[model samples]
Target: MARVAFILLCHKDPDAILNQVTRLTAAGDYVAIHFDASAAPADYRKITSALADNPNAIFVTRRVRCGWGEWSLVEATLRTLQAAFDAFAQATHFYMLSGDCMPIKSAHYAHRFLDAHDKDFIESFDFFDTDWIKTGLREERLIYRHYFNERSQKRRFYAAFALQKRLNITRAVPTGIQVMIGSQWWCLRRSSVAAVLAFTRQRPDVIRFFRTTWIPDETFFQTLVRHLVPGREIESRTLTFLMFSDYGMPVSFYNDHADLLLGQDALFARKISAEAHRLKQVLGALYASDRTDFTISNEGRTLFSFLTARGRSGRRFAPRFWEAEASIGAGRSLLIILCKKWHVAKRLTAAIRQSTDIPAFDYLFHEDDTPLPDMGGIERSLAKRGRHHRAFVRMLYDHAGTDRVVICLDTSSLDLLGDFHADRADVRILEIDCDLGDDYLIGHAIRVGLAGPQTSRDTFARLLPTIRRDMIHERDAIRDARFKNAARLRETATDAENAAALAVFLGVDDTTALALAQTPHLFVD
Candidate 1:
């Protein structure tokens, strides 16, 4: 097996760091980590404890504060490489990664493939003439030296014009040299790392020169490799993983995007949020299982293992009617009338109205709808009383045409379902929020051993929303309703008050309640 060394730069979120380390160490690869001294000792100790038993792991020298766009990143990276080189001399290559970074490939494939090239894969793009290095740099340097860096304020004020001149000249200078940037996370041979350290040691002036420039991380290795061997040994292309970018933010992958990631044949991908359990399950089966040939972690786990996975499926996709045409079944042309309280409902209604096939929707409660007395004489002027109270009341009468599918807003529940009476068959109140909340709670209940799989899926669905809503909306009216146990309702009501029932008392969807029940672990404190 080709040995690999993983280097992680740790700062905050020690739990996340520990999980990454555990997964990497379990993969049978050597690991070296540099925790920025900027973090508290307790946090540092926590990560250290997690890696204590691993023979392939080492905690590097003391951490240092890394200023963004400065030499700190390169300094930290070099320190990690030096430590990895000394401790695991037999390792084939060193992979630089961040604490939140995840591996998209199987370890077996990564090890075999990396063993072949085992050369420098840094990607440098030329930008000497670009405004990023010219005008932008001059403007930023003045701001940084004079205002941001208090220690060098007086000295910078005198040299400010000179610095501006230098940046202008730099913009005109074309050093056909490209500043390599693939993934900051790279798979590099030991010789490449040794060369980086050796060159840095001999040329302290070069190191100091870059330390003064912005984005030292991008330039540090780029300058070294170019100055060291020119175009002889260093490969222009990088072997690291890739992720697509749109606009500015990264395009996150879903289970639907699985084929794209796998087909790309990259070593790793940028990031994977723990919230998507369905994607995790799909990816786990594909990449983290024995049936498949590729494996990234030796411990037989995938990137999903580190994140909280409970109730993930519920949030994956928006709820939608599967068969409006089929279900309508020759009835008085079914219309899904969107009610108020759900702002997104207006868009949905407009979309349905625009559709050629489906029954058109009647947008109610809009300015065109008949105004209520409290809604003021103005066209769409509903009185602005307490925000939550007015919202629920407006929701009660938002629908215009009675003969339609009066699906209530996200705030819709069985309790409020009785207010509207259209054609009994046509008036279906779709309790979307209630349904999702039930599913999330059920998932959590199962995970924490609060309920068995056989436990009624409808347990919370039928009982809680009504009971919870009543406690919130009509706390004083509890004396009227007939209940098997009034005291139990009161107690649950108190729990709701302290917990998420407050949202119910206010008029918004019970997001607080659903969030608490769905992510119980998060609400532990």
Candidate 2:
């Protein structure tokens, strides 16, 4: 029975906004929309006319021309919030969302949690005490007077910034109020929101000071909420899952990001691209579900964040900048075989070589016996490759000819799974479980001297390579997820099935693959 008043600040993507407004109003939630005056007039009319019949949707007439790092963004939010508050008096909470934002969690789940814990979900930290501002002016954003639009008018904006810094111009903050800064998105209890509105009318001096402050939208609500709400009642975290690049811009979400977004504990997410049809569809479906027992979003958040950072900002654990391990580029058509039974893998490699015109290489990555075509002596080559994940893959791509080349993954090759995830454009990964028996792994381990012959299957299994033991750990990232949908072929699989898998990868027919299965062993170690 908890009603939320949603304040939506939208500039583009009217279709997405209309979908969001419709979904929210249909679910018995109220929305106050402020179509930015800077946006296309046709889009505004398109969205408003579509939602005119919905009693829960209210369009703010006093729209402001909003821009980044400008006071207008904050003013626009206030106007929409006030309009929603006046219309939906029964609303218990107010949630702020953007044009690119959408709920990832169910309304029932949100209401139940909000009802149980009457906490204000807003991130507020002492601005002067934290290193939160990475790219912009830190403490000067608050202390220095700002008058120009920071985003659209960069030269004049920085000119004013320089003039203030030269003259040592400082603005005095009102007494007894410690300035705070946080994310612009938030979910707050109605009382705290109403208090903010009241503070605006009562303290014109504070408003005037902030109006000249750089990116006041990020600080105004955050600082005011802290001044009004008790520390105990405020949870210093927004209920929206937001991420930013090193450039301080919101990371846009695409269809492939569905898993990461769905696994988030946040009720909502932003910067979801309108062109991301698949992700939008998935969110639309999940938002309607009443289930509260959802997957824990924080469990995988750390690794995903690391991988994201690794992809965007070149990885720290690599040799050079762009040559980040997870971003190794392809120089030729490549197919990588991930397997356990090396002896069996060699047989398949031989089959591919003898049965067709294509060539296959095995033990190409063995630390002692790797065979490179162009690189010098093995020692010098290994030294040149540097024995690093990024280096190994880069060396391989450089020597591997423009024509198709096949190599079996080696245990000696450091973790290239991340690199494989990135360069899978020309890479084809196929996993084969060539079973001898339930004890086959143990027997193979012993035969290969990987473990003691007397050891149990469980012990031998543990001695296998990481990929041989576990298939999908870091593989959870990127297009390499296609490994999940790949056909699982056994050693004794139907010659047709085996042929099909090999053929699909080799770009040949099943007949050629069958011939490969019978060909003489040619890939000698």
Candidate 3:
């Protein structure tokens, strides 16, 4: 039997299904683990203990924060591969998979299929404009890098000015930079593994450049393979669809997609439905020797659970709907201020640039304090100049057809949004506070790609306490005489009314608002 080493990078997923791991290990294969470094020591111990039971399994070095499009992940994967090669030199292939992934075919079938191909599968997609991925890659290299550099080096006045020219330079990255569409997960031969590391080591500068680039994972493998292996031997097709089920994000397979996953072509389905227990059961049976029970140590399943449950309690932007709405408004004139932290700001601005509507007002800087001096004088001279800065602000309001402003506040711009939102009730303010109860849910949902009824319940459990606590704080703040006077002036005639009004101000419901106004002393924890 030919041996394959499965290299899995996992984090915060003690509940990942180990049955699949068990099946692969039992199939005369080796398993090498690299759990996320941030995972608790206790959890790591549990993971090690569970894998230790399998003869082919052994825990390697600690993990790191493997951000998308970051160099850390490439470094981590390379280290893991070296360890795997050292631990099991005779293994025929080294397959890099995530905690959320699953093998679709039986172990025997998988081995046979690969043996026949004599090829390495990586999902490398072609870039034609208009496609989200293509546009995204372009912006990351050009526009985003400019704005990112500008914001970080605010003191370097000349550097900020230079960013404008750099942003428009088309085909900025090497034309030879061929992008392949494969699952970041790949099944590779020993030779390919050695080649990847050697190329990366040789081109340390390239690695350093990509370290700061966004979604480094997508490009890291593709760039290396394109540079190292001749394109002929490297199969661009990853043997999996790896599509997100709903909301246009990667997710677990639900009942509806089960047949699609089980169909003829693909060797593995990178994700499973977090909401669909049935899908899990089906996958469990495919890998299990007996019984229908599918619970195993796959972290993807657990992360899926955490996310879907969290998403239910929080706000979510359906990608398709977001795109459609933005599309309809695309041809229109609008003003969009990109006031997020450097990274988040770049993402939002890039999305805006991708939109169909060409914005009339595109402000990239974050702080209100640092208003462009050119704009500041115009604002002061607005009455005399008539069609100047005030006109610009008025034009923005007219374009939107509402007095309300939609501001996306990430980690950095929270304070500004908080103060601004409090003053402008007409503004439809959305605070994308990653710390909010529902925010946590959204994070989890995106990572694991699961959603449904049970997921909703989990969200409520996580969110309710947070809501209650926030309200409790609100109640106490309203008791001061000055607070009462201010409430009265704001048309909040009574304490209950004041609380209710405050709740509305805070974007909470009536019940939550009342709880905050009446029981400020109460702490949720």
Every model: Cα RMSD to truth:
17.3, 14.9, 17.4
Model 1 quality (TM-score): 0.47
lDDT of 1 by residue, 180-282 (tens): 3323556667777788789778877565555655556755676566656546566665454444332334446655545435534466655556564565556
> Model 2 segments beyond 4 Å from truth?
309-525
Candidate 3 per-residue lDDT, tens place, 1-525, comes to: 456898877776676636556766776888877777766889888777787667687676656755444556767787788888888988988888777676666666676777887777775555333253623245445223322332334565336435645675433454445543335777788888888877767766566566655555666776667667777888876665475433556755667655445543566686665566677677666753432222222233343344454424242213232222222121222222222122333343344334323232223223243222244354334242222222434444555564433233332333332233233133332111112335544443434343323334444454446444543333332232121112210212444764554344434467654554444322111
What would the TM-scores of all predictions be? 0.47, 0.61, 0.49
- Global lDDT of each model? 0.49, 0.72, 0.52
**Which model scores highest in TM-score?**
2
Q: Is candidate 1 or candidate 3 better by lDDT?
A: 3
Write model 2 residue lDDT over 1-525, tens digit each, in one string: 688889998888897888888888777888999999989999999998999898899999988998788889889988998898899998999999987887778888888878988899998999889877788588888888888987788899899989988998887788778899899999988899889999999999898888889888879999999999999999999889988775777888899777656656688998788688888888887778787766642423343343454334232322344455443454555677766556667777777766666667675555345545655553344454544544455455556544576777642222454355455346666666554343554454445444443343333343444324332333233234454324344555666776677777777876787776454432222
Best by lDDT: 2
Pairwise TM-score winner, candidates 1 and 2 = 2
The list of candidate 3 runs beyond 4 A from truth reads: 126-139, 142-182, 245-247, 288-525
TM-score of predicted structure 2: 0.61
Error of 2 at 468 (Å): 10
- By summed lDDT, the worst window of 10 consecutive residues in model 3 runs over 481-490
